[model samples]
Target: MSVLVRTEGRETAAGAIRPQAGLSTASRVAAVTVLTSLPVFLPGAANGLICAELGWSPVRMGAVLAVYWLASLSGAFVSRRAALPPVVERTLSIALFATCLGLLTAAVAPAVGLWISSAVGGYAYGYTQPHTNALLMRRCAPRLRAFAFGLKQAAVPTATLLASVAMPMLAGAGGWRLVFAGTAVLCGAGGVFLVRQGMRHGIRPGHSGARHPAATRDRGAPLRVGTFLVALSCAGFFGAMVGNGLGGFLVLALTTRGVSLSAAGAVATAGAALNIAVRLAMGWLVGRVPQVAWAALTGLFLTGAAGTALLTRPGLGAITVGALLAYGGGWGWAGLLHYAIALPYAGQEQRATAYSQMGVSLGAATGPLMCGLLFQLGPDAAWWALTAAGSAAGACVLVARGHVGPRPDAGVSPARRRPRDSPRPA
Candidate 1:
């Protein structure tokens, strides 16, 4: 069997995978980002609104969010075997459109109905990352893939930023429903736009140029490789814990510590802005930095832990400092860890990313519940719980790094994987 390839903006030697020169990445990136934000939008930025409007405690809101992520678990699993580009585009648009409907339902429906909406929306959320990864893998060059992933991930913070800014403006307008309804509209519009792009610039595999020798159709792999990849997957779980956990509770955490509601929202936005900046910059910096991927992953998590612990300190100044650290450092590792997950499984981008997504989704699904349980113990204690989770995740990255060794038979071409002082770790 031949290897699959990463032929994003260029072509390979004749007789290799087909060229996708005309395929504009902007559309794919937008599609994925919009879909990704749908399920996560409310849970991340509007948690305070959700709790207030529904009259539920933080724990109750966390439970609903947890269930939403849990539902995504299945989609992540099925992503192990990826589909053709057209299939991905079709499914992605349809699922995102459906998620928009679900978001609308969550906005207007009663308590029980809202939970049902979360569940429906969750299943659609699962499809976005893996499918998007598959698309990016095919489109991005190996050298620039990290940045590509980062650009796509920037949407997370973009979504958060929008929601955070709108929190106060939209509050009490029609309660949480108004915000949720807006989410539905955005996602639905994104889907329609992507589908139109897909129709115009369709998938054409026969035109593919260069192919990865190991990125073949065969699904099975060596046990050692699978075992090593699992460590990275575990790290993904921890990374998600940092992002989902923090994003879910930051506002509440600050409010509990005596910050006003608007102040808390502003803090969340600042942190999210920092996060966005770091992620976008992290990808570009990876090329300049000498640290190996695993080492960077480990350090990012540790920084997150420290930031979480810092929130234990009193005063607005400390809280602001902690927010930047937690958001910038804690949430920053998602793209880096994602890039690492793709390395060992070099050829099999879909399968590699599926494992990574599973880890992330599982962490995201459960992190809120775990943090919420700790929240009942107070903000300081809850942060400590986050610290513990972050520490564990760092350890996993350390372990995963050990296994990132040479695979002469598979991996990128020697010229492509040329050694420098350190490998890229975006």
Candidate 2:
């Protein structure tokens, strides 16, 4: 079902055999990571407020975002071919510009205008991943790659945390429109910076994989890669279903659980902080025992299910703990998940990452929309639906792991630490 190779490299307390990523490369990766996600959540942070003020139904809200997420998926695929800079520079510039314009549209436009922004923003959101990963694949060292990926993944919650903090302040200062306008300006500047940064760094001519003569091998051949891709796709579908569901709805969900609008934003903020911590933790955890990283999904999903159920109760303490588990535990796997998939197809990390993203986009697009429909039945039912989704997602990952054929490095997993000698037969 799958193959594993001994890890090409790793970093440690002793020293790194592979060269480490220098400060400049690391900073660039981090900056790109943050900028890519920041714009996506600017609108999301105020989703609940928008609904409350306009009396827009969740169904409509979810539908518009579903359209947005789908568009983002397309963006990833589109960016797949344009792997090098200048071309990449133009692509990112266009994407960020579109995001800026879309946010402007959302700020002033009516219902139809909101939908238009959804498509525009979604396109940019989708394109960011493949290209960004491609850059990292080339720049980051094998030893440091997993941690880099994990830290980069933390951008999601960082973006969410910013949105949470900004929304409440912006709403009070100048209403929500000011938030969109301000975020647009930030995104526009970020667009310019992204392109300039690449030029400054002296980007190489070719895309990754084939670009590096040594990395040219299609590490996992067509059938093998295809099967795992399908499996990871299913993983993306359900895992992202849960993660995005929480991201898109946590503040809104908290409000229904008796939280004040202002307080709900705080709860969302707390959840985002915990989410970042867990993603970093997952990075370290997998770096130690990557072969088993896929297995960790089961634990995270179950935690999400428990967390979602906890939220159905009626207390602030429960709400906080639940959000930590749901957001921290449920949503933390993304970085590790992406890293795991990329390790197998290191050469084609960009395109491989895109396949995984398709699963994520599919789930993200539908998760909220499905939950919106469930909310009509009652709030508890929605939580139950999330629980079901988490459970299903966990099963998909476990199944994927099982399908994997043991590679030589399988024994390197921490789980296989049994002693070779049996006490010399005592």
**Where is model 1 more than 4 Å wrong at Cα?**
1-27, 43-57, 82-87, 170-178, 203-225, 288-292, 406-426
Lowest-scoring 10 consecutive residues by lDDT in candidate 1? 413-422
Candidate of highest lDDT: 1
Best by TM-score, which number?
1
TM-score for each model: 0.82, 0.80
Local accuracy of candidate 1 as per-residue lDDT tens digits, 1-426: 001223232434323423242124623564466555656566545676667767878667667778777777777777665553434566677776888888887777747756776787777767557666666555555545566667777777776666656766785686667877777887788778757756665546575644434444223542233545677788778778877888878888888777898898788878888887887777666634424454566787888888888888998988888878888888888777766665444445566677787888899877777777788878777788888888888888766555555553322221233122222333
What's model 2's lDDT at 87?
A: 39
Total backbone collisions for each predicted model: 11, 2
lDDT of 2 by residue, 1-426 (tens): 000011122113213323344224444555555655654566566777888878897667767767778987887667555443433455566667787788788888746657777788777777767666655545555555566667778877787677768888878879887888887787688777756754554335552322342133443333134455676677777777778877777777778766898888677777778888888887767666666576676688778888887878778888788888888777888876677666554446666678777778888887877777777787777777888888887777766565444554432132322112101111
Error of 2 at 355 (Å): 1.2
